[model samples]
Target: MTEHVDVIVVGAGISGIGTGYHLQARCPDRTYMILEGRAAMGGTWDLFRYPGIRSDSDMHTLGFAFHPWTAAKSIADGPSIRAYVEETAREYGIDRKIRYGHHVKSAAWSTEDARWTVEATGPDGPVTLTCNFLSMCAGYYNYAKAYSPEFDGADSFAGRIVHPQFWPEDLDYSGKRVVVIGSGATAVTLVPTMAQTAAHVTMLQRSPTYIVARPGEDRVANWLRGKLPSKAAYGITRWKNVLMGMFFYRLARKKPAKVKERMIGMVRDHLGPDYDVATHFTPRYNPWDQRVCLVPDGDLFAAINAGNASIVTDTIARITPDGIRLDSGKDLPADVIVTATGLELQLMSGVAFSLDGQPIELAGRLQYKGMMFDGVPNLSSTFGYTNASWTLKADLTAIYMCRLLNTMTKRGLRQATPYNDDPTMKSESFLDFTSGYVQRAAASLPTQGERKPWKLNQNYALDVLALKFGSIDDAMRFSNPGRSKDGRSTDAGTLQTA
Candidate 1:
């Protein structure tokens, strides 16, 4: 027998937890369950167990609005972050609603019934659950696949290879020559931290990434917290970082040259004048074009300067028993290899779904206000900012979703969908990116358009006003209950349609 509920939330990450919390808070009597694929509650934080894994943004902005992060350090490591998420769920009674080990395989929307039929796989057996609403919070990154570049002799390597996502706890790298691939956030983060213990750590990359150095702690906020109330201090810090992020983003987009020069200056300041800045720190593209990697206190550069770490920028020819062979004919020997070669993001985590018995191609659908999809009613995905803090956008999304739900309940509606009649519309990406992961799966996911709701503006300033203060009527199409699923229904709330 299939169980029925008011809503079904996929994944138990911050997004899923936040959504479930909001839904329950708005409609206390409504029943909802969270289906998490993993065994634990913390999603990304739990998955990545690498050394020095932490937030690029400060905790003040990265943390939830309702929950103020009281950590002394602004930049929190993975363990602290995981603890915070678990704490939030526990405090809000969200942990009780989560069904761990339950992975959603497919969902089918019935137009006749105006409900979604979801099938999931669990440890016990396959369970079927029917719900009036299906909210996807699976996140963008693919949990299973880690990008390990195919080297000609990768099979011949004698040493153990590890990805940050799947690093074993028992593995040791002390006094060993380790080479880390890629220069993104993960690689940059691992290099310095590993150099501390590892005898020698070589950070190899095909091209340089734009690096920004910021103090690990928010000085002003730290001082204010000591002098004023924690709430006021946190609020002030959150907006300060938000506005600073916005200014820099606009500067990068509008005045690219000036921002580039300033970034170069930062690199020069961190790594003395004698070091070659162009080869390692300077990126080919503009800052924020690809997400910039952040280093607290320039630790990565400091490690290189101290001769504990080295930077290699040659193409990989193959892997050997000893180490990696570069395309430039230079062989870098290592005892252990760390493949930090980016992430493979599978939007919605390959969960199959169809709307009204018709296959819903996410790319072909119009995005309603960059959060909700057109032609798909009563649902929205919480996609965070690629360039900014994830929780900043997520907090706004949760608030907006709650507002929409409350509005519907007040107006006596049951369902809502986005309506679009533009025939010339085409699929586009939400981010201005050229990453391998996004380009590879462009055909399967939701595509952004050239304008307005279709264009995903990653600006927090605009998103704040749009999501927090914008009128729901401007984007959402509201309707009253004229016909019920059983052909006999009464008006309880307003239902919006696509």
Candidate 2:
């Protein structure tokens, strides 16, 4: 017999766990289960085992709104974050509702039944389940694959080539020369970390990224933690960080040239007058065009200053047996080459979705309030912000989802679908980011409108106002409380609201 739940959450990561908490706290009567494909929880934290793996965003904001991060370090390591997520799950009893090793294959929505029939591959074999609502918190990246561009003569490299997503546990790099490719977060992290034990490390990049250094600990937060309660301190610090981040982002956007000058000057100060700041640290685009790489306490800069690591700004010519040959005719000899490339962006965790026997092409659909897709009934996917910390948006989304669920229950509605009624509403890319990963998967992502409810503001303060307090009935069509399986109304049912 197939089991049934009020809601089925896709992944048991931060988003899923947070959603679980909200459902329990706000909608105590609703039953939900989390289906995680992996053996353990902590999705990204558990998957990535690379060195110097830490959050670019501060923990105070990255941590859940309800949970307070008690750690001294604002820039937390991966293991600590994994533990924090697990601890939150255990505290709220969300871990008990998770079904491990359940890889969801596909979902079919039935308008007549007003529920989703979900199929998955479990340890035994194929398993079937049903849910009134399906919440996809499976993250935005492909876990099994990393975005690795084709490098010429890669096969003839002769040395071990490793991707950061699938770092080997036993591979030793002690006292070995390592060359890390890319200038994003992963490359910036790996360069300093590998440089510690390696004989030498070099970061190779096609273009420079905006890299900034910040202290690992927040002094104000630390002081507030001692004087105030944990929750109060956390709340204050979270808002403080949020406001500061918003201010800087607005400043960057409004005065790009001025902000760019200040940012590049900071890098120059770090590397001294002799270092080639323009070539190695200055980015072609303005700040936040892509994400700015954050190095805790200037660790990456320190590594370079100590002669432990170096940066090379050039394109790859080809891979030789000994090392990589650059376009500038420089040979970077390496014992190990780490491809700290970007991630393979995936939508709804690449699960095949269908609605009432018709396949759902997400790319062609419009995003509704950055959560639900237009014309898709009883489904919502959690996609966080590109500008700010992911959890800021994620927390608001979970809260909004609870509000939606409660509203549906109160109105005796079984189906809630977003409809884009305005034909003149122009569609735009799902994300405004110019990052390579986003651009690579642009054709596969959903679209947004040029106006409210369909447009993503990317601002946490604005998102909080829109998601937390916004009207739930705007542009949303709700129906199907007493409808038959044959697409006929069995009773008059509740009034249809849009």
TM-score of every prediction relative to native: 0.94, 0.98
lDDT of 1 by residue, 187-273 (tens): 999999999999999999999888888888878988989998889888988999999888888889999999999998888898889
Off by over 4 Å in 2: 481-498
Query: What digit string (tens of lDDT, one per residue) describes model 2 on residues 1-498?
Result: 899999999999888898999999988999999999999999888899999899999999989989899999999999999999999999989999999999999999988788899999997889999999999999999998899988898999877999999999988999998999999999998999999999999999999999999999999999999999999999999999999999999999999999999999999899999999989888889888899889999999999999999999999999999999999998999889999889999977889999879999999589999999998988989998888888888788888888999998998888888888899999999788899999988998899999988988899999888999989988888876456678674423534334
True-vs-predicted CA distance for residue 131, candidate 1, Å: 1.7
* Cα error of candidate 2 at position 42, Å: 0.5
Task: Kindly report the root-mean-square deviation of model 1 from the true structure over all alpha carbons.
Answer: 2.5
Candidate 1 runs further than 4 Å off: 425-427, 479-498
Distance from true position, residue 331, model 1, in Å?
1.0
lDDT of each: 0.83, 0.91
